[model samples]
Target: MEKLIDCHFHIWDLDANYYPWLTDNVSENVTKITGDYSSIRRNYLVEDFRKDIGDLNVVAAVHVQADADPKDSVKETQWLQSVADGSGNGMPQGIVARGALNADNAEEIIEAHCACPNMRGMRVEMHPGLNAPADYNPLKDEKWLRNFALLQKHDLVFEVRAASPEQTKDVIQLMRDHPETNFVFPHLALSIWRDEEAIAAWKRNIKIFGELPNAYIKLSGYGLFGLGWTTEMVRPYVMDVIDAMGPDQVVCGSNYPVDSMAAPYSRIWETHFQLLDDAGITGADRAKILHDNGKRVYKL
Candidate 1:
Protein backbone atom coordinates (compact mmCIF):
# COMPACT_ATOMS: atom_id res chain seq x y z
CA MET A 1 0.00 0.00 0.00
CA GLU A 2 1.26 3.49 -0.91
CA LYS A 3 1.27 6.27 1.66
CA LEU A 4 -0.42 9.46 0.34
CA ILE A 5 -1.74 12.82 1.40
CA ASP A 6 -5.23 13.58 0.01
CA CYS A 7 -4.86 17.33 -0.37
CA HIS A 8 -8.57 18.01 -1.20
CA PHE A 9 -11.22 15.81 0.48
CA HIS A 10 -14.29 17.31 2.22
CA ILE A 11 -16.38 16.32 5.29
CA TRP A 12 -19.63 17.96 6.23
CA ASP A 13 -22.31 17.47 8.88
CA LEU A 14 -25.49 18.86 7.33
CA ASP A 15 -27.27 19.07 10.68
CA ALA A 16 -24.33 20.74 12.41
CA ASN A 17 -23.51 23.25 9.64
CA TYR A 18 -25.73 24.41 6.80
CA TYR A 19 -24.16 23.89 3.37
CA PRO A 20 -26.40 25.65 0.88
CA TRP A 21 -25.36 23.29 -1.87
CA LEU A 22 -26.44 20.30 0.16
CA THR A 23 -29.41 21.74 2.06
CA ASP A 24 -30.92 24.19 -0.42
CA ASN A 25 -33.25 22.98 -3.22
CA VAL A 26 -30.48 20.46 -3.91
CA SER A 27 -31.97 19.23 -7.18
CA GLU A 28 -32.71 22.73 -8.49
CA ASN A 29 -29.41 24.26 -7.29
CA VAL A 30 -27.22 21.29 -8.19
CA THR A 31 -23.76 22.06 -9.51
CA LYS A 32 -23.86 22.28 -13.30
CA ILE A 33 -20.26 21.06 -13.49
CA THR A 34 -21.16 17.70 -11.94
CA GLY A 35 -24.71 17.69 -13.27
CA ASP A 36 -27.09 15.80 -10.89
CA TYR A 37 -25.28 15.40 -7.52
CA SER A 38 -28.13 13.59 -5.77
CA SER A 39 -25.84 10.74 -4.79
CA ILE A 40 -23.70 12.61 -2.20
CA ARG A 41 -26.24 15.01 -0.66
CA ARG A 42 -26.06 13.23 2.73
CA ASN A 43 -23.88 14.03 5.72
CA TYR A 44 -20.30 12.77 5.13
CA LEU A 45 -18.41 12.60 8.39
CA VAL A 46 -14.77 11.67 9.09
CA GLU A 47 -15.77 8.06 9.85
CA ASP A 48 -17.51 7.83 6.47
CA PHE A 49 -14.31 9.04 4.81
CA ARG A 50 -12.28 6.40 6.70
CA LYS A 51 -14.62 3.63 5.52
CA ASP A 52 -14.52 4.93 1.93
CA ILE A 53 -10.72 5.09 1.88
CA GLY A 54 -10.56 1.48 3.23
CA ASP A 55 -6.96 0.17 3.44
CA LEU A 56 -5.23 3.08 1.65
CA ASN A 57 -2.61 4.61 3.93
CA VAL A 58 -3.75 8.21 3.85
CA VAL A 59 -1.06 9.53 6.21
CA ALA A 60 -2.69 12.96 6.30
CA ALA A 61 -5.51 14.85 4.58
CA VAL A 62 -6.57 18.44 3.94
CA HIS A 63 -10.25 19.38 4.27
CA VAL A 64 -11.43 21.98 1.75
CA GLN A 65 -14.47 24.06 2.69
CA ALA A 66 -17.71 22.18 1.95
CA ASP A 67 -19.58 25.24 0.62
CA ALA A 68 -20.94 25.98 4.07
CA ASP A 69 -22.93 29.21 4.38
CA PRO A 70 -20.53 32.19 4.60
CA LYS A 71 -21.98 33.14 7.99
CA ASP A 72 -20.58 29.85 9.28
CA SER A 73 -17.21 30.03 7.50
CA VAL A 74 -15.01 30.27 10.58
CA LYS A 75 -17.32 27.92 12.38
CA GLU A 76 -16.66 25.30 9.70
CA THR A 77 -12.91 25.52 10.35
CA GLN A 78 -13.44 25.23 14.07
CA TRP A 79 -15.71 22.26 13.49
CA LEU A 80 -13.08 20.55 11.34
CA GLN A 81 -10.39 21.19 13.96
CA SER A 82 -12.69 19.60 16.51
CA VAL A 83 -13.11 16.67 14.16
CA ALA A 84 -9.32 16.36 13.95
CA ASP A 85 -8.93 16.48 17.72
CA GLY A 86 -11.73 13.99 18.40
CA SER A 87 -11.38 11.66 15.40
CA GLY A 88 -8.45 9.83 17.14
CA ASN A 89 -6.43 9.71 13.90
CA GLY A 90 -6.10 13.44 13.17
CA MET A 91 -7.23 12.56 9.65
CA PRO A 92 -7.52 16.12 8.40
CA GLN A 93 -4.24 17.75 9.39
CA GLY A 94 -4.96 20.88 7.32
CA ILE A 95 -8.01 22.88 6.24
CA VAL A 96 -8.77 25.38 3.43
CA ALA A 97 -11.59 27.40 4.97
CA ARG A 98 -13.91 29.70 3.04
CA GLY A 99 -13.14 33.42 2.86
CA ALA A 100 -15.25 35.83 0.85
CA LEU A 101 -12.44 38.07 -0.39
CA ASN A 102 -14.63 40.86 -1.70
CA ALA A 103 -16.89 41.10 1.36
CA ASP A 104 -16.78 43.95 3.89
CA ASN A 105 -15.76 41.44 6.57
CA ALA A 106 -13.15 39.72 4.39
CA GLU A 107 -10.13 40.50 6.53
CA GLU A 108 -12.01 39.77 9.76
CA ILE A 109 -13.26 36.45 8.37
CA ILE A 110 -9.75 35.51 7.26
CA GLU A 111 -8.35 36.42 10.67
CA ALA A 112 -10.89 34.20 12.41
CA HIS A 113 -10.24 31.34 9.99
CA CYS A 114 -6.49 31.57 10.63
CA ALA A 115 -7.10 31.41 14.38
CA CYS A 116 -8.10 27.76 13.87
CA PRO A 117 -5.07 25.53 14.48
CA ASN A 118 -5.78 23.22 11.49
CA MET A 119 -6.24 26.03 8.98
CA ARG A 120 -3.53 25.86 6.30
CA GLY A 121 -5.23 28.20 3.80
CA MET A 122 -8.44 29.77 2.45
CA ARG A 123 -10.54 29.40 -0.75
CA VAL A 124 -12.63 32.11 -2.45
CA GLU A 125 -13.97 30.76 -5.72
CA MET A 126 -12.87 33.00 -8.60
CA HIS A 127 -14.64 31.07 -11.33
CA PRO A 128 -17.97 32.84 -11.63
CA GLY A 129 -19.22 30.85 -14.61
CA LEU A 130 -17.86 29.13 -17.69
CA ASN A 131 -18.91 31.97 -19.99
CA ALA A 132 -18.45 34.91 -17.62
CA PRO A 133 -15.89 37.50 -18.71
CA ALA A 134 -12.41 37.34 -17.16
CA ASP A 135 -12.79 40.69 -15.43
CA TYR A 136 -16.11 39.57 -13.96
CA ASN A 137 -14.09 37.74 -11.28
CA PRO A 138 -13.24 39.23 -7.87
CA LEU A 139 -9.57 39.22 -8.82
CA LYS A 140 -10.34 42.42 -10.78
CA ASP A 141 -11.66 44.14 -7.66
CA GLU A 142 -9.20 46.15 -5.58
CA LYS A 143 -10.92 45.16 -2.33
CA TRP A 144 -10.51 41.46 -3.16
CA LEU A 145 -6.86 42.05 -4.00
CA ARG A 146 -6.38 43.92 -0.73
CA ASN A 147 -7.98 41.09 1.25
CA PHE A 148 -5.98 38.50 -0.73
CA ALA A 149 -2.73 40.23 0.29
CA LEU A 150 -3.52 39.25 3.89
CA LEU A 151 -2.62 35.66 2.93
CA GLN A 152 0.99 36.73 2.42
CA LYS A 153 0.96 38.60 5.74
CA HIS A 154 -0.25 35.49 7.58
CA ASP A 155 1.78 33.00 5.51
CA LEU A 156 -1.43 31.20 4.39
CA VAL A 157 -2.00 29.50 1.05
CA PHE A 158 -4.68 30.66 -1.43
CA GLU A 159 -6.53 27.78 -3.10
CA VAL A 160 -7.46 29.07 -6.59
CA ARG A 161 -10.58 27.47 -8.21
CA ALA A 162 -10.85 29.20 -11.58
CA ALA A 163 -12.49 27.04 -14.29
CA SER A 164 -13.06 29.19 -17.36
CA PRO A 165 -10.36 30.40 -19.74
CA GLU A 166 -11.28 33.98 -18.86
CA GLN A 167 -11.07 33.17 -15.15
CA THR A 168 -7.81 31.26 -15.68
CA LYS A 169 -6.29 34.33 -17.39
CA ASP A 170 -7.32 36.54 -14.49
CA VAL A 171 -5.88 34.02 -11.97
CA ILE A 172 -2.57 33.89 -13.85
CA GLN A 173 -2.37 37.68 -13.60
CA LEU A 174 -3.37 37.43 -9.92
CA MET A 175 -0.48 34.99 -9.32
CA ARG A 176 1.94 37.47 -10.92
CA ASP A 177 0.48 40.31 -8.84
CA HIS A 178 0.98 38.37 -5.61
CA PRO A 179 4.39 36.84 -6.18
CA GLU A 180 4.95 36.33 -2.47
CA THR A 181 1.72 34.40 -1.79
CA ASN A 182 1.50 30.63 -2.35
CA PHE A 183 -1.42 29.52 -4.59
CA VAL A 184 -2.72 25.97 -5.02
CA PHE A 185 -4.89 25.48 -8.13
CA PRO A 186 -7.31 22.67 -7.27
CA HIS A 187 -9.32 20.29 -9.54
CA LEU A 188 -6.93 20.61 -12.51
CA ALA A 189 -8.11 24.20 -12.58
CA LEU A 190 -11.54 22.56 -13.19
CA SER A 191 -10.76 21.23 -16.67
CA ILE A 192 -13.44 20.75 -19.33
CA TRP A 193 -11.93 17.47 -20.53
CA ARG A 194 -14.35 16.65 -23.36
CA ASP A 195 -13.65 19.83 -25.22
CA GLU A 196 -10.47 19.97 -27.33
CA GLU A 197 -10.40 23.75 -27.60
CA ALA A 198 -10.82 24.02 -23.84
CA ILE A 199 -7.96 21.57 -23.31
CA ALA A 200 -5.73 23.69 -25.56
CA ALA A 201 -6.55 26.80 -23.57
CA TRP A 202 -6.04 24.89 -20.28
CA LYS A 203 -2.65 23.60 -21.47
CA ARG A 204 -1.61 27.13 -22.42
CA ASN A 205 -2.91 28.73 -19.20
CA ILE A 206 -1.41 26.04 -16.90
CA LYS A 207 2.07 26.75 -18.32
CA ILE A 208 1.98 30.29 -16.94
CA PHE A 209 1.34 28.97 -13.41
CA GLY A 210 3.89 26.18 -13.94
CA GLU A 211 6.55 28.82 -14.66
CA LEU A 212 5.76 30.77 -11.48
CA PRO A 213 7.59 29.54 -8.37
CA ASN A 214 4.60 30.30 -6.09
CA ALA A 215 2.01 28.16 -7.93
CA TYR A 216 0.96 24.48 -7.68
CA ILE A 217 -1.99 22.50 -9.18
CA LYS A 218 -3.90 19.61 -7.61
CA LEU A 219 -4.70 16.53 -9.75
CA SER A 220 -8.16 15.64 -8.44
CA GLY A 221 -11.79 15.70 -9.56
CA TYR A 222 -11.47 13.66 -12.75
CA GLY A 223 -15.12 12.84 -12.02
CA LEU A 224 -15.82 16.20 -13.64
CA PHE A 225 -15.32 14.40 -16.94
CA GLY A 226 -18.52 12.48 -16.03
CA LEU A 227 -19.18 9.21 -14.16
CA GLY A 228 -18.44 6.77 -16.99
CA TRP A 229 -15.04 8.29 -17.82
CA THR A 230 -12.17 5.85 -18.48
CA THR A 231 -8.44 6.25 -17.83
CA GLU A 232 -7.69 6.76 -21.54
CA MET A 233 -10.53 9.23 -21.94
CA VAL A 234 -9.03 11.41 -19.23
CA ARG A 235 -5.35 10.89 -20.10
CA PRO A 236 -4.79 13.85 -22.42
CA TYR A 237 -6.21 16.34 -19.93
CA VAL A 238 -4.19 14.91 -16.99
CA MET A 239 -1.01 14.53 -19.05
CA ASP A 240 -1.34 18.05 -20.45
CA VAL A 241 -1.28 19.44 -16.90
CA ILE A 242 1.61 17.21 -15.78
CA ASP A 243 3.43 18.06 -19.01
CA ALA A 244 3.04 21.79 -18.47
CA MET A 245 3.34 21.95 -14.66
CA GLY A 246 5.76 19.01 -14.29
CA PRO A 247 5.17 16.32 -11.65
CA ASP A 248 6.87 18.40 -8.95
CA GLN A 249 4.29 21.19 -9.20
CA VAL A 250 1.33 18.80 -9.16
CA VAL A 251 -0.43 17.53 -5.99
CA CYS A 252 -2.95 14.68 -5.58
CA GLY A 253 -6.41 14.85 -3.95
CA SER A 254 -9.56 12.72 -3.79
CA ASN A 255 -12.02 15.68 -4.15
CA TYR A 256 -14.25 13.07 -2.58
CA PRO A 257 -17.99 12.78 -1.87
CA VAL A 258 -18.30 15.40 -4.60
CA ASP A 259 -16.34 13.11 -6.93
CA SER A 260 -18.00 10.05 -5.41
CA MET A 261 -20.95 11.12 -7.53
CA ALA A 262 -18.74 10.05 -10.45
CA ALA A 263 -16.77 7.06 -9.09
CA PRO A 264 -15.89 5.17 -5.93
CA TYR A 265 -13.25 6.69 -3.62
CA SER A 266 -10.84 3.77 -4.10
CA ARG A 267 -11.25 3.86 -7.89
CA ILE A 268 -10.33 7.53 -7.96
CA TRP A 269 -6.93 6.77 -6.46
CA GLU A 270 -6.47 3.78 -8.73
CA THR A 271 -7.12 5.96 -11.76
CA HIS A 272 -4.62 8.57 -10.58
CA PHE A 273 -2.01 5.93 -9.85
CA GLN A 274 -2.57 4.47 -13.30
CA LEU A 275 -2.26 7.91 -14.84
CA LEU A 276 1.08 8.41 -13.06
CA ASP A 277 2.30 4.94 -14.01
CA ASP A 278 1.43 5.32 -17.70
CA ALA A 279 3.17 8.68 -17.73
CA GLY A 280 6.26 6.89 -16.37
CA ILE A 281 6.22 9.11 -13.26
CA THR A 282 8.23 6.85 -10.90
CA GLY A 283 10.29 6.91 -7.69
CA ALA A 284 11.01 10.37 -6.21
CA ASP A 285 9.03 12.28 -8.86
CA ARG A 286 6.08 9.93 -8.35
CA ALA A 287 6.34 10.23 -4.56
CA LYS A 288 6.28 14.01 -4.87
CA ILE A 289 2.90 13.93 -6.59
CA LEU A 290 1.38 11.17 -4.46
CA HIS A 291 2.84 12.27 -1.10
CA ASP A 292 5.78 14.68 -0.67
CA ASN A 293 4.53 17.81 -2.47
CA GLY A 294 1.29 17.73 -0.45
CA LYS A 295 3.24 17.57 2.83
CA ARG A 296 5.38 20.54 1.79
CA VAL A 297 2.57 22.62 0.22
CA TYR A 298 0.01 21.97 2.99
CA LYS A 299 2.81 22.28 5.66
CA LEU A 300 1.73 18.92 7.17
Candidate 2:
Protein backbone atom coordinates (compact mmCIF):
# COMPACT_ATOMS: atom_id res chain seq x y z
CA MET A 1 0.00 0.00 0.00
CA GLU A 2 1.19 3.54 -0.68
CA LYS A 3 1.94 5.68 2.31
CA LEU A 4 -1.03 7.96 3.02
CA ILE A 5 -1.14 11.69 2.65
CA ASP A 6 -3.53 12.92 5.36
CA CYS A 7 -5.41 15.65 3.51
CA HIS A 8 -7.64 16.95 6.30
CA PHE A 9 -5.53 17.16 9.46
CA HIS A 10 -6.11 20.06 11.91
CA ILE A 11 -3.50 21.74 14.12
CA TRP A 12 -4.40 24.11 16.94
CA ASP A 13 -3.42 25.31 20.40
CA LEU A 14 -6.42 25.88 22.68
CA ASP A 15 -4.27 28.03 24.98
CA ALA A 16 -4.07 30.56 22.17
CA ASN A 17 -7.85 30.95 21.71
CA TYR A 18 -11.25 29.56 22.64
CA TYR A 19 -12.58 26.71 20.49
CA PRO A 20 -16.24 27.19 21.45
CA TRP A 21 -17.24 23.84 19.98
CA LEU A 22 -14.88 21.93 22.25
CA THR A 23 -17.13 22.15 25.26
CA ASP A 24 -15.89 21.13 28.69
CA ASN A 25 -19.21 19.49 29.58
CA VAL A 26 -20.80 17.01 27.22
CA SER A 27 -24.58 16.93 27.00
CA GLU A 28 -24.47 14.74 23.89
CA ASN A 29 -22.41 11.53 23.70
CA VAL A 30 -19.75 13.33 21.71
CA THR A 31 -16.02 12.66 22.06
CA LYS A 32 -14.15 14.76 24.59
CA ILE A 33 -11.56 17.08 23.09
CA THR A 34 -8.07 15.90 24.01
CA GLY A 35 -6.50 19.33 23.33
CA ASP A 36 -3.13 17.70 22.75
CA TYR A 37 -0.63 19.51 20.56
CA SER A 38 2.38 17.64 21.85
CA SER A 39 1.91 14.68 19.49
CA ILE A 40 1.48 17.00 16.51
CA ARG A 41 4.67 18.81 17.37
CA ARG A 42 6.39 15.52 18.06
CA ASN A 43 4.82 13.33 15.35
CA TYR A 44 3.43 15.37 12.42
CA LEU A 45 6.34 17.61 11.51
CA VAL A 46 8.70 16.61 8.63
CA GLU A 47 11.00 14.31 10.60
CA ASP A 48 8.05 12.76 12.39
CA PHE A 49 6.08 12.31 9.17
CA ARG A 50 9.06 10.55 7.57
CA LYS A 51 9.43 8.29 10.60
CA ASP A 52 5.73 7.40 10.65
CA ILE A 53 5.54 6.92 6.91
CA GLY A 54 8.72 4.80 6.74
CA ASP A 55 9.24 3.44 3.21
CA LEU A 56 5.79 4.65 2.18
CA ASN A 57 5.78 8.06 0.53
CA VAL A 58 3.71 11.19 1.08
CA VAL A 59 3.50 13.06 -2.22
CA ALA A 60 1.60 16.04 -0.87
CA ALA A 61 -0.81 17.26 1.80
CA VAL A 62 -3.64 19.80 1.83
CA HIS A 63 -4.23 21.55 5.15
CA VAL A 64 -7.99 21.78 5.62
CA GLN A 65 -8.96 24.96 7.43
CA ALA A 66 -9.54 24.68 11.16
CA ASP A 67 -12.35 26.72 12.68
CA ALA A 68 -10.16 29.40 14.25
CA ASP A 69 -9.73 33.13 14.05
CA PRO A 70 -9.79 34.11 10.37
CA LYS A 71 -6.49 35.94 10.78
CA ASP A 72 -4.96 32.90 12.46
CA SER A 73 -6.01 30.83 9.44
CA VAL A 74 -3.52 32.60 7.19
CA LYS A 75 -0.90 32.60 9.93
CA GLU A 76 -1.30 28.84 10.42
CA THR A 77 -0.95 28.25 6.67
CA GLN A 78 2.22 30.33 6.63
CA TRP A 79 3.65 28.40 9.56
CA LEU A 80 2.81 25.01 8.03
CA GLN A 81 4.29 26.02 4.69
CA SER A 82 7.47 27.17 6.41
CA VAL A 83 7.72 23.85 8.21
CA ALA A 84 7.23 21.97 4.93
CA ASP A 85 9.78 24.13 3.11
CA GLY A 86 12.36 23.92 5.87
CA SER A 87 11.90 20.20 6.44
CA GLY A 88 11.60 19.42 2.72
CA ASN A 89 8.43 17.53 3.64
CA GLY A 90 6.53 18.66 0.55
CA MET A 91 6.05 22.36 1.35
CA PRO A 92 2.62 21.78 2.96
CA GLN A 93 1.71 21.09 -0.67
CA GLY A 94 -1.51 23.13 -0.61
CA ILE A 95 -3.42 25.20 1.93
CA VAL A 96 -7.19 25.54 2.18
CA ALA A 97 -7.42 28.65 4.31
CA ARG A 98 -10.62 29.80 6.01
CA GLY A 99 -12.80 32.58 4.62
CA ALA A 100 -16.39 33.82 4.88
CA LEU A 101 -17.37 33.44 1.24
CA ASN A 102 -20.88 34.75 1.85
CA ALA A 103 -19.74 38.12 3.20
CA ASP A 104 -20.01 41.27 1.08
CA ASN A 105 -16.25 41.63 0.58
CA ALA A 106 -15.70 37.89 0.14
CA GLU A 107 -13.75 38.40 -3.09
CA GLU A 108 -11.25 40.62 -1.34
CA ILE A 109 -10.89 38.09 1.47
CA ILE A 110 -10.08 35.34 -1.04
CA GLU A 111 -7.60 37.52 -2.93
CA ALA A 112 -5.75 38.35 0.27
CA HIS A 113 -5.43 34.65 1.11
CA CYS A 114 -4.47 33.72 -2.48
CA ALA A 115 -1.52 36.10 -2.20
CA CYS A 116 0.23 33.47 -0.07
CA PRO A 117 2.34 31.05 -2.18
CA ASN A 118 1.08 28.01 -0.31
CA MET A 119 -2.56 29.03 -0.47
CA ARG A 120 -4.08 26.88 -3.24
CA GLY A 121 -7.71 26.87 -2.14
CA MET A 122 -10.35 28.18 0.26
CA ARG A 123 -12.32 26.08 2.81
CA VAL A 124 -15.61 27.75 3.67
CA GLU A 125 -17.25 26.25 6.77
CA MET A 126 -20.91 26.36 5.77
CA HIS A 127 -22.24 24.16 8.54
CA PRO A 128 -25.59 25.84 9.22
CA GLY A 129 -25.37 24.63 12.79
CA LEU A 130 -22.13 26.55 13.25
CA ASN A 131 -22.41 29.41 10.77
CA ALA A 132 -25.09 31.94 9.83
CA PRO A 133 -28.15 30.66 7.91
CA ALA A 134 -27.37 32.79 4.89
CA ASP A 135 -24.01 31.06 4.31
CA TYR A 136 -25.84 27.79 3.72
CA ASN A 137 -27.07 29.12 0.39
CA PRO A 138 -24.06 29.94 -1.77
CA LEU A 139 -25.97 30.21 -5.00
CA LYS A 140 -28.72 32.36 -3.58
CA ASP A 141 -26.39 35.13 -2.52
CA GLU A 142 -24.74 37.34 -5.14
CA LYS A 143 -21.74 37.93 -2.92
CA TRP A 144 -21.07 34.19 -2.58
CA LEU A 145 -20.99 33.95 -6.39
CA ARG A 146 -18.60 36.89 -6.53
CA ASN A 147 -16.32 35.16 -4.03
CA PHE A 148 -16.55 31.92 -6.01
CA ALA A 149 -15.73 33.82 -9.16
CA LEU A 150 -12.63 35.19 -7.51
CA LEU A 151 -11.52 31.64 -6.70
CA GLN A 152 -12.11 30.72 -10.31
CA LYS A 153 -10.09 33.72 -11.40
CA HIS A 154 -7.18 32.62 -9.21
CA ASP A 155 -7.79 28.95 -10.16
CA LEU A 156 -8.09 28.04 -6.49
CA VAL A 157 -9.90 24.87 -5.50
CA PHE A 158 -13.05 25.20 -3.35
CA GLU A 159 -13.23 22.92 -0.30
CA VAL A 160 -16.74 22.92 1.17
CA ARG A 161 -18.31 21.30 4.27
CA ALA A 162 -22.08 21.06 4.53
CA ALA A 163 -24.25 19.65 7.34
CA SER A 164 -27.24 18.64 5.24
CA PRO A 165 -27.92 16.77 1.98
CA GLU A 166 -29.80 19.72 0.48
CA GLN A 167 -26.81 21.93 1.02
CA THR A 168 -24.76 19.46 -1.02
CA LYS A 169 -27.04 20.03 -3.97
CA ASP A 170 -26.76 23.78 -3.53
CA VAL A 171 -22.97 23.47 -3.63
CA ILE A 172 -23.11 21.16 -6.65
CA GLN A 173 -25.24 23.72 -8.47
CA LEU A 174 -22.75 26.40 -7.60
CA MET A 175 -19.96 24.24 -9.02
CA ARG A 176 -21.99 23.59 -12.14
CA ASP A 177 -22.51 27.32 -12.60
CA HIS A 178 -18.78 27.88 -12.31
CA PRO A 179 -17.46 24.90 -14.21
CA GLU A 180 -13.95 26.24 -14.12
CA THR A 181 -13.67 26.15 -10.33
CA ASN A 182 -12.54 22.86 -8.78
CA PHE A 183 -14.67 21.73 -5.79
CA VAL A 184 -13.55 19.29 -3.10
CA PHE A 185 -16.44 18.04 -0.92
CA PRO A 186 -15.03 17.07 2.43
CA HIS A 187 -16.41 14.44 4.92
CA LEU A 188 -18.67 12.87 2.31
CA ALA A 189 -20.97 15.87 2.64
CA LEU A 190 -21.12 15.02 6.38
CA SER A 191 -23.69 12.36 5.47
CA ILE A 192 -22.94 9.77 8.12
CA TRP A 193 -25.63 11.20 10.39
CA ARG A 194 -28.39 10.82 7.78
CA ASP A 195 -31.19 8.24 7.79
CA GLU A 196 -31.49 5.59 5.05
CA GLU A 197 -33.62 7.76 2.81
CA ALA A 198 -31.30 10.67 3.29
CA ILE A 199 -28.31 8.48 2.55
CA ALA A 200 -29.89 7.26 -0.67
CA ALA A 201 -30.67 10.82 -1.70
CA TRP A 202 -27.12 11.89 -0.92
CA LYS A 203 -25.71 8.97 -2.86
CA ARG A 204 -27.81 9.85 -5.88
CA ASN A 205 -26.77 13.49 -5.70
CA ILE A 206 -23.13 12.51 -5.28
CA LYS A 207 -23.40 10.36 -8.41
CA ILE A 208 -24.80 13.35 -10.28
CA PHE A 209 -21.99 15.59 -9.18
CA GLY A 210 -19.38 12.90 -9.81
CA GLU A 211 -20.09 13.35 -13.49
CA LEU A 212 -18.53 16.79 -13.25
CA PRO A 213 -14.80 16.59 -13.90
CA ASN A 214 -13.96 19.41 -11.53
CA ALA A 215 -15.76 17.87 -8.51
CA TYR A 216 -13.88 15.66 -5.99
CA ILE A 217 -14.69 14.12 -2.59
CA LYS A 218 -12.52 13.61 0.47
CA LEU A 219 -13.08 10.36 2.39
CA SER A 220 -12.72 11.74 5.93
CA GLY A 221 -14.60 12.28 9.20
CA TYR A 222 -16.99 9.28 9.07
CA GLY A 223 -15.94 8.28 12.58
CA LEU A 224 -17.36 11.49 14.02
CA PHE A 225 -20.91 10.32 13.15
CA GLY A 226 -21.01 7.22 15.35
CA LEU A 227 -20.64 6.90 19.10
CA GLY A 228 -18.92 3.53 18.63
CA TRP A 229 -15.13 3.75 18.32
CA THR A 230 -14.19 1.10 15.79
CA THR A 231 -13.01 1.09 12.18
CA GLU A 232 -15.42 -1.76 11.31
CA MET A 233 -18.47 0.39 12.10
CA VAL A 234 -17.30 3.05 9.66
CA ARG A 235 -16.51 0.59 6.86
CA PRO A 236 -19.96 0.49 5.24
CA TYR A 237 -20.19 4.28 4.96
CA VAL A 238 -16.66 4.62 3.62
CA MET A 239 -17.19 1.77 1.15
CA ASP A 240 -20.46 3.24 -0.02
CA VAL A 241 -18.72 6.57 -0.70
CA ILE A 242 -15.80 4.94 -2.54
CA ASP A 243 -18.16 2.84 -4.63
CA ALA A 244 -20.22 5.89 -5.50
CA MET A 245 -17.40 8.35 -6.17
CA GLY A 246 -14.79 5.79 -7.30
CA PRO A 247 -11.22 5.73 -5.98
CA ASP A 248 -9.54 8.03 -8.50
CA GLN A 249 -11.58 11.07 -7.50
CA VAL A 250 -11.51 10.29 -3.76
CA VAL A 251 -8.70 11.17 -1.30
CA CYS A 252 -7.96 10.32 2.32
CA GLY A 253 -8.23 12.79 5.20
CA SER A 254 -7.54 12.28 8.93
CA ASN A 255 -9.75 15.16 10.20
CA TYR A 256 -7.30 14.99 13.10
CA PRO A 257 -7.57 16.78 16.44
CA VAL A 258 -11.37 16.75 15.99
CA ASP A 259 -11.25 13.02 15.19
CA SER A 260 -8.68 12.40 17.93
CA MET A 261 -11.45 13.21 20.43
CA ALA A 262 -13.19 9.95 19.47
CA ALA A 263 -10.31 7.66 18.51
CA PRO A 264 -6.55 7.99 18.78
CA TYR A 265 -4.56 9.07 15.71
CA SER A 266 -3.35 5.48 15.17
CA ARG A 267 -6.90 4.12 15.18
CA ILE A 268 -7.95 6.73 12.63
CA TRP A 269 -5.16 5.58 10.33
CA GLU A 270 -6.15 1.94 10.90
CA THR A 271 -9.76 2.68 10.00
CA HIS A 272 -8.71 4.05 6.62
CA PHE A 273 -6.60 0.95 5.99
CA GLN A 274 -9.53 -1.29 6.93
CA LEU A 275 -11.81 0.50 4.50
CA LEU A 276 -9.35 0.16 1.62
CA ASP A 277 -8.67 -3.49 2.43
CA ASP A 278 -12.35 -4.36 2.63
CA ALA A 279 -13.01 -2.63 -0.66
CA GLY A 280 -10.33 -4.78 -2.36
CA ILE A 281 -8.90 -1.80 -4.17
CA THR A 282 -5.67 -2.13 -6.18
CA GLY A 283 -2.38 -0.60 -5.00
CA ALA A 284 -2.34 2.09 -7.69
CA ASP A 285 -5.91 3.12 -6.88
CA ARG A 286 -5.09 3.03 -3.18
CA ALA A 287 -2.05 5.18 -3.88
CA LYS A 288 -4.28 7.69 -5.63
CA ILE A 289 -6.67 7.96 -2.70
CA LEU A 290 -3.79 7.85 -0.23
CA HIS A 291 -1.79 10.68 -1.82
CA ASP A 292 -1.71 11.30 -5.54
CA ASN A 293 -5.23 12.66 -5.95
CA GLY A 294 -4.62 15.18 -3.19
CA LYS A 295 -1.37 16.18 -4.87
CA ARG A 296 -3.21 16.73 -8.13
CA VAL A 297 -6.10 18.64 -6.54
CA TYR A 298 -3.84 20.90 -4.47
CA LYS A 299 -1.23 21.13 -7.28
CA LEU A 300 1.38 19.99 -4.78
Per-candidate Cα lDDT values, in order, are 0.83, 0.67
Query: Which numbered prediction scores highest in TM-score against the true structure?
Result: 1
Residue-pair clashes per candidate, as listed? Answer: 0, 0
What TM-score quantifies how close candidate 1 is to the native fold? 0.93
Error of 2 at 127 (Å): 3.5
Q: Candidate 2 on 1-300: residue-level lDDT in tens?
A: 466677876554445443334423331222222334333331234454445444545555667766555545556566666665776456466788886767776776766677678888887766554445644555566776666677888888888765466666677778788888888878765543467889778778778766887888887775556535576666676777788778878888867655654666566666777788889977788888887888788887
Give candidates' CA RMSD values in order: 2.3, 4.2
Q: Write the per-residue lDDT of candidate 1 for residues 219-264, one digit (tens) a residue.
A: 8888877778788877887888888889879999999889888788
Off by over 4 Å in 2: 14-59, 71-73, 85-91, 133-136
